[model samples]
Target: MSSISRPSAAASAHAETIRFEAADGHPLEGTLTTGPGHGPLALISAATAVKRGFYQKFAESLVTEHGFRAALTYDYRGTGGSVSQDFNPRHISMADWGMKDFPAALARLELVAPGHRVVGVGQSYGGQALGLGNVSERFERYLMVATISGYWRNLGGGFKLYALMNLVANPVAFLVGHVPSGMGLGSGLPGGVFSDWTRWCNRPDYFFSEEPRFDAKNLFASVRTPILAIGATDDPWGTPAAREAIMRHFTNAPVETRWLDPQEAGGPIGHLDFFRSRFRETLWPEAIGWLKGEAQA
Candidate 1:
């Protein structure tokens, strides 16, 4: 076996917990897993409502098995470890998470692993947020897993879930101060975060048509980084059409899109399972090779 190849849980103790300030001055919590040797720095961005911990095992594997110098995972404002303050009703938005929080995470990673090349690995909404963020151009390459625009029509069976968010969860979030934890959205979300997601998913134009807060076309047109977008054939939330919708926004990026069927992944690998530890034997190594520029779509 290679020197760096090891089980994910075996290297958990080596991870270092740290704090970094966001562009907006919000203190964000993160964990940095240092590899056995120096290599590229990886910033693993989590999906919506997903905590930094959700990516811990994946981050550990990247450092322990893939030869990355370090892998950083952080929580967005108002979620997970970043929610150290009283946020009965935090006034944050999805755009803030994309434009502000992600950039801050990038800056933090750059500081933590100076002189090392940076590779961005964004899962689902994590990938969407990176494209919309300001500092994405700083990365050498991007590996976006299950990334897609929140267009309701292209969601296949996921439209029901989006509809419920728009009609039920959103109202409860505004009234109850947070998205209900029992709803199983990885983690409970702030009212504003949930509402903003609903507003974007409910609209046909998604974030592209929104004004004042963002100019999606102009924002993504500047992206020239090589992109590798991986999607699942069985993921209703990130269907092929949905992925295309989001990829269309990155007008300048040379994007390579790949679809993996559950059978090829050894089981029913849906949107969430793409990053699950179980796939470490399958997709994980493929992802690492792709990020290293050792493989192609």
Candidate 2:
């Protein structure tokens, strides 16, 4: 129901603006990249505070070196370039991204580029959204990096506070049309996204709880696509328990889980740096190797 601006000149050559209708009739914005070679298509979902540009470097790398035909990335409603006129910064919910934004993007891709084997790469909250969306047989494979399956008991200091504020302050902020100054976990998020994230943090089970259940485990169980779950040993957000929780959900999917430490990888790659840093020259090789192996099999 809201208009999304086209990609800027800096990104236009490698990206194109795409519009698609969701099952609920909401309009979704996306970026499509068609590289020179023929291969499977990849869709990238952004983390909580980052936008699609955060994925530009890695998507381009996948396109040029890996021979992928295209990569599609998009912003969920109320974030970055996809803000809606009806968007009340205090009233947004993470469920909107999982149920509406992500599915709409996938449906659009299916319509626009029919018959291509699609792959999804998700990071952090994006990984959660992908997990919530589930990997259907429509996709060739699924890759989850720095993903959190649920919030459970052992989140962290910042996250615990975030959850608390959402329970106590969010409604008050909504009535007053402002978010508390320190409520945001990370920078660059609009008030709506911040509030939505706060709500997730407040809940012990994250997206898997009965109250606002998104059926993440059901999605994983039904996935016919191969999966690769990547986590960093030093990432507090993607702790061992969190990573194991995600793996457990995908019981039926063929999956490989890797725990990477900067020391073991012979680099300083941490959680977010795996996509943003020069370590891609080392890291992507392993990823591509796995992808190729899966393709051959």
Candidate 3:
């Protein structure tokens, strides 16, 4: 493996733009947040449709607070920095994000910090996708935030029915050949990614229940890394039931599940808010401490 060059110190502390390639040879874009040498390496994976920059502050904190050797945040194919001006969206799928994009990031991390044990800190779909990827064995541990099954029925109130109708986004994607930034829809998702996502959320078992299902069940079951799965009490996408539904797939991983209550910390910690900069004083430190094994679960 070719060594990944570190940027100048000024550029390394914040966002150091980097490029890598997937197994399929698709170019991917990311940023590295560097720390002092000889610390653990980390990869901060973003949620679906969320760009790498969304986790900029969080990635930086891994160095400032947790003393990571370096932290990475990358965009999936056809999104954000990874998408070239001439990129084609017609052929992408959710499986590509898991089985391909994530593994690419893991490979990049290995080259960036050759001997360090890697920690995967993923948010929402980011954490879910990790299990489907083939690189889980490379991770020393996982920090799963707001990551849960979107099976819909596990959610409370009318949200389940609303999620069942998420399939409506698929028709729009088919018509436009890409998902438009419509109400309740993520922008720039490939037609197949959007369709596959809706298909998972609408099913009784999400991705695991699909016919001719992707190999996620087997992949996840094989993971032996320790996992800390955090679900927000107020998060519609990752309720207690939703978290339980998806985490069961990791049959061999020893997972410690925790519910983060925004009420206890004085904020509305929804599905996406847990990683926001505002919580740097609250959930952020708590999570970092957890990953460092500073405290018991």
Which candidate's lDDT is highest? 1
What are the per-residue Cα lDDT tens digits for candidate 3 across 1-297?
223554533443655788888898877888877867456788888888788887888887778766778888899988887875455676778888888899999888788668777889988888887788877888888999988887777765356455434646667777887776654654567777877877787777888855465667787898888999988888866777888888999899999988888888679988788878888887887778777767655
C-alpha lDDT (0 to 100) for residue 46 of candidate 3: 86
Relative to the true structure, candidate 3 reaches a TM of: 0.90
Candidate 2, residues 1-297, lDDT tens digits: the string is 333444433332356667665566555677776666667788788777667777877777777777777787888776666666666655655667766788777876665468877878888777666556653666777787887754545444455655556665566555665454445443344456556565556565655554434565576577667778888877766677767755677677787788888887767655577787476677776776565444422
Q: After superposition, how far is residue 5 of candidate 1 from its true place, in Å?
A: 23
After superposing candidate 1 on the true structure, give the runs of residues whose Cα lies further than 4 Å from its correct spot.
1-8, 11-13, 86-88
Estimate the lDDT of model 3. Answer: 0.79
Q: Per-candidate TM vs. native?
A: 0.92, 0.81, 0.90
What's the C-alpha lDDT at position 179 in model 3?
77
lDDT of 1 by residue, 211-280 (tens): 8768878888888889999999888688878888889988889999889989978988788788888888
Model 2 alpha-carbon drift over 4 Å, by segment: 1-13, 89-91, 150-152, 156-184, 187-196, 211-214, 292-297
Clashes of 3: 0
Query: What pairs collide in candidate 1?
Result: none
lDDT of 1 at 99: 87
